[model samples]
Target: MKLGPIDWAIMATYFVFVLGIGFALRRYMKTTTDFFQSGRSIPAWVAGLAFISANLGAQEVMGMAASGAKYGIMTSHFYWIGAIPAMVFLAVFMMPFYYGSRARSVPEYLKLRFDEKTRGLNAITFALMTVLSSGISMYAMGLLLNLLLGWSFDVSIWLCALIVLLYITMGGLTSAIYNEVLQFFMIVFGFLPLVLLGLHDVGGWAGLKTGLEHVAVSNGFAAGAWSQSWAHMGSPTDNPMGVEWFGMAMGLGFVLSFGYWCTDFLTIQRAMASESMSAARRAPLIAAFPKMMFPFLVILPGMLAIVLHQRLGAGGFSLPTKADGTLNYDMTVPLMLSHYFPQGMLGVGITALIASFMAGMAGNVTAFNTVFTYDIYQAYIRKGAPDAHYLWVGRVATVAGISASVAAAYLATHFNNIMDMLQLVFAFVNAPLFATFLLGMFWKRTTGHAAFIGLISGTVGAAIHHGLTLPLGSVPGIKGGWLGLTHQYTSEMAQNFWTAIWAWSTCFVVTILVSLVTKARAEAELKGLVYSLTERLKSDAEAWWRRPAVLGVIVLALTLVLNIVFL
Candidate 1:
């Protein structure tokens, strides 16, 4: 597909606006705190929007649309069941210890509440994860650009990396945060029209459902299987996702969602940048409102793509297929843009995707730099450094992070399945983290030694489980069963859910058992860091709507309605 002059103009304007913001904020990045933490001066609304945009990356946009095509409305569970509750929990229950304790990063919080070794382990793993995630974002953006416009993948990756690095290195966290707020608007505007136009061509919601009904029947499912979320979740084989209620609810809703939304440093860093404890608490809650409604914006397009080719025939675009002829579901959204958008609107759509790429890549890079500079470098390599020196190191780390991501992007081109393998690594690394944080913050008796040991045990248990089990019709390799195929799963999603459950359970049980035998820290030292040790803060003075708990309740109620309506 070729772009018109109008399209190039819109794309050029976005690049200029982002760079302008970076240069605009250059003066404020003098101190290490300013560079790393946005000087802790961001208002709640700004922080809140940044929090949402930071996570609205390639995975959320492209990956979700892909899943929506494959799994139907059951994919909404990622938002309704998996994300909203955890984000609310973060704002209402967990933000106090994180914000009150003055810990700069999540791993730093582990150090404050647990011990150095626990913090060190978390910092290294998190740092590596960020690099890998950023790299994948690059690959996604590059691949999509290449497919859509025949752009050089190498040039696309480097040019985008250069832009992210320039803005982040110059304006620091403040620039990235503010730019993220802008990107959020671009993404929403870009995709909203696409959803509307796609729905129109499919003859609105009712007609779209009829088309999907045909698809569901063709795929050997019940008529409503592709249109409803919970109706087909009774058994693995009943739904397109091949995941049962127990595994979906416990594994995704409880473990993976909480593990990511609550504990991961990427989202938490945005909340941490808020100016006050109240603002910090409100940030994620503010993010929850949009998050609850995102399925309509992101997921529906994939659903539309499912039957568009059948509707429009020669005029429509179908998803690209892999070597084995399986549809490359990730291409669903980009191809939809090419199919439905006009010349000028097409530019806006492409720019929106680029915004998502930036948000994902920049979020990971900023978080990676902060963690490396404070938790890794300062604590281990160089201690008691002057403020100016660390600030310089932070700028240096930003460049290094971008370079590492670029390298990973090139590595991705050579190995098509590398991302699937990396997901396994992230599963083991991230699945056990919430248990460590949960016990460390809420249970004062939890020992540092136990937190460290439990993390290892959790990751090991996840690997062992994956090794012993294989999803049906898969070979014993990256997909698992290297040890022996003792059990089988109907789908990879089910396998992932079970892996998370086992990881979380192993970590939780091991942490408690070891903490029972090990020594606990003094209660005085735990103040402000442990939940019970600290005084409970309140939003009672604020209006009912502004209160975090109240907002959380409202968000959850709306999500419940959506699930039921779709079901």
Candidate 2:
């Protein structure tokens, strides 16, 4: 596992190039807008790439692969169903409110649509989640470096924190977005070869599937688990994912997907940074093209890992294991890299790993700084501050955000798996967010009080469901339910989907009930914010094919084809 001089050179070159980009973009930070939103001057393609890159962090790259290893092709549901539809919805339907309203952040839109309390709740929750997610990436980076390169965990964390802080502080969101694009390329370059090589070693896709089928047969599981997506989804006990089709669609596709893609400030901020309304509207759609194909790169590696492990045996190509002999699925990608990549390419693979960590960390810190500065500091602490003063606050907040992430990284060390911990957080924070946004945008009757209370109730409901239903000894950091309903869940994944379902249901019902009793805002005040009041701004100047609706239809159709093919 020792890296050669050429590998070191490649890694060093990547760091220099990224830092150089940051310094080169330093001239753009002339205003708070530029610092926070890239002066709204980014092109549609660049914004689109950054939109996906910002999310292509450790959690995604590694987690998706991990899920592929654990749950087979069913993991593609996270992409085809859970992401593409929501991303399309964001681009075609939601972007007008987000972009046309001229709101700087998602929470800002809430403030305009609902009230200050709703905005406050969203801003604070989003800020905390961003930092914690950054911390998780940081922690995963350190853990990978420790496992792969024998680097000290603490040293790895601090080194990554310092690197992210340096580039992001120098150029702000503009720098982060640019680096994310670069990271996206690096990830493709790094992992594409590994997948090709691994596929070759596993004797191509057909051989890999056959190998997994044999493994499943030997292990006393369904033979089609590795190849089929929906066949085993009829019951939780039939597959490793343990999620029924209804729960997968309603919980993951409708609730979690929309919540993250449409509402989460992390990805939305990238679209918001686009130079024009057309670019903003097109960003997610453009990102969706690449996203539809990402399972091939990310998830395939995990499937290959399983084939390699089964073929080579434990002594030949080792899989990461916990003390209890269970697979540490988060290490799937790293294990593949260690097994397949050679010297020069090894550096590329490791650099991609580092790039994912840095990009993810930068994404979170940049979003955190922007939200905290504008939504919290400007709105609450000191309104009408000089633009320069706010810019300074943003930079300071960037530092604070990264610092908090470092602390959170330390906290994450206690968790057994990075992907599980991330999913747990998503269940807690993101699952219920879409319901509030869905009501506020389309329904003018959704009062601020209702939005705020429903959000709180939904979040609390998610926690309660976890406590009541999650089984003991199921996964790390989760014990049996306080209500002694531990036997209710067929698997932890099932528990997660059900948790989201309950959370979303609670929010949806509660918001409706409260909004019924509360007075709706005046129509004049709802202009450009609510769906009914806003004009349908058309992109008529563009060709018919380029229209968001047209692109959305194409994407949806393609996604349907993918689902059927995999099913």
Candidate 3:
């Protein structure tokens, strides 16, 4: 894993451009809109790429790779089944209300569509979620850098934090979006070569499949289990993922996917930055293009790492272990980079990871600052502050958010799989959120009080469900069952899926029941917010192919083909 001077030079060169972009955009930061919302002037394509790149952080790169190592091709479910349809639904159905309502953040939308309490609840929780998610990006970078460079973990995380802070604080959302686009390119170029080389070493797709059979069989799964996506999903015991198709479809695919893609403000903020409603709608639909290709760049590396380690024996690397003596799957991607990459290319690979780390953390910080400035601080702390004063608060919030994330980074260290921890958070937060948004936007009769009550009930239900269920072999603690184990799941991921399902169902049911007893808002007040009340959106695109629906259909078809091919 030793690096040469050539590798150092490549990394050094990348930092210059990253900082230069921020410094270049600093002159435009005279107003809050310019700083926090990118002046709503970014083109659809730029916003689109940034949409995907904003998510290209620790969870996507390291976490997906980790899941790939543990679950094999079943990990692609995160993209094919879990992400694609949801992105399509967002662009085609949800973005109209989001863009049309002129809401500043997701919480602001809830306020416009529901009530103050629901908005307040979402804003505070979203602020915390962004900080924690940002911390994940920080923790992964810190840990990976420590492993690769033998640097102190504390110093590495802090240094990365300082770099992101300067750029994001300087140019704000505009800087974060532009840098995310750059990170997207760097990630593709840097990681595509690794995938190519790894595939070559393992005899391409056929050889990789052959190699995975032994690993799958040794782990108590059916032969060829690692090579197929849905084939082994009929029974939890048939595959490494250890969840039935029903849970996979209803939980990860329906609840978690729609919850994140539709409701989470991180990716939604990128689209909201676009110049026009047309562009905003097009953003996520277009982002799905690159999102579809990421399994190879990230997931395949993990799959290859595992097989290659076994094939190459002791000279090759093994995954790191947790304090409890189980494999720490989060190390899968970095270990693969160290094993397969040569000196010059190794720098590119490392820089790609750095780019992802920055895009992810910066996206979170920028979103956090905006939500704090508008949704929380403006609404609660100071109602009539001047834009100048609020702008000042945003900059201050950026500093505070990063500081909190640095603390939260330590919290992530307690988990064996970083993805497991992130999913648990999403299950508690986003899963129930989709229900609130669903009823609020579609059923004008849904009252604000009902929405607020439903949100609390959903979050509480998630906590209860999580506490009552234990992932097999995990003791009652962070992984759940502290309240007493009523049900046990085969894997942590399986537990996450079912927990999300329970949370979503609870929220959906409670919202409807409460709405029946509560009085609805005036129909006039629901105008631009509710689906039945609002007029349908017309595409501004001149060509048929440019329409969001057209693009969404094309991508979904391609994704379907991939799923079937892999199956």
Among the numbered candidates, top TM-score falls to 1
Instruction: Show the lowest summed lDDT stretch of 10 residues, model 1.
Output: 309-318
Overall local distance difference test of candidate 1: 0.91
Off by over 4 Å in 2: 313-316, 414-426, 472-480
Q: Write the per-residue lDDT of candidate 3 for residues 1-567, one digit (tens) a residue.
A: 787999999998988888899999999998899999999999999999999999878567888888888889899999999999999999989999999997988999999998888999899888988898788778877877887788789998888889888998899999999999989999998888888888888889988898899889888889778889999988888888889999999999999899999998999999999999889989998899888888888899889877876676633657777999877888787777777788998999888988898888999999999999999999998999788898899999999999999988887787547646664665587769999999998888999988988887887899899999998889998899989989999888788888888888899999999999989899998899999999987775458888888898899999999998999
lDDT of the candidates, in the order given: 0.91, 0.87, 0.88
Assess the local accuracy of residue 22 in candidate 3 as a C-alpha lDDT between 0 and 100: 92
Candidate 2 residue 349 C-alpha distance from true site, Å: 0.5
| Clash pairs (backbone) in predicted model 3 | none
Q: Which stretches of candidate 1 lie over 4 Å from their true place?
A: 312-315, 416-419
User: After best superposition, candidate 3 residue 470: deviation in angstroms?
Assistant: 1.9
Total clashes, candidate 1?
A: 0
Alpha carbon lDDT of residue 380, candidate 2? Answer: 92
Instruction: Provide the TM-score for each candidate, comma-separated.
Output: 0.98, 0.96, 0.95
Residues 225-268, candidate 2, lDDT per residue (tens digit)?
77788888888777877778898898888888888899988999
Sort by lDDT, top down from the best: 1, 3, 2
lDDT of 1 at 560: 88
Give the Å shift of residue 211 in candidate 2.
Answer: 0.9
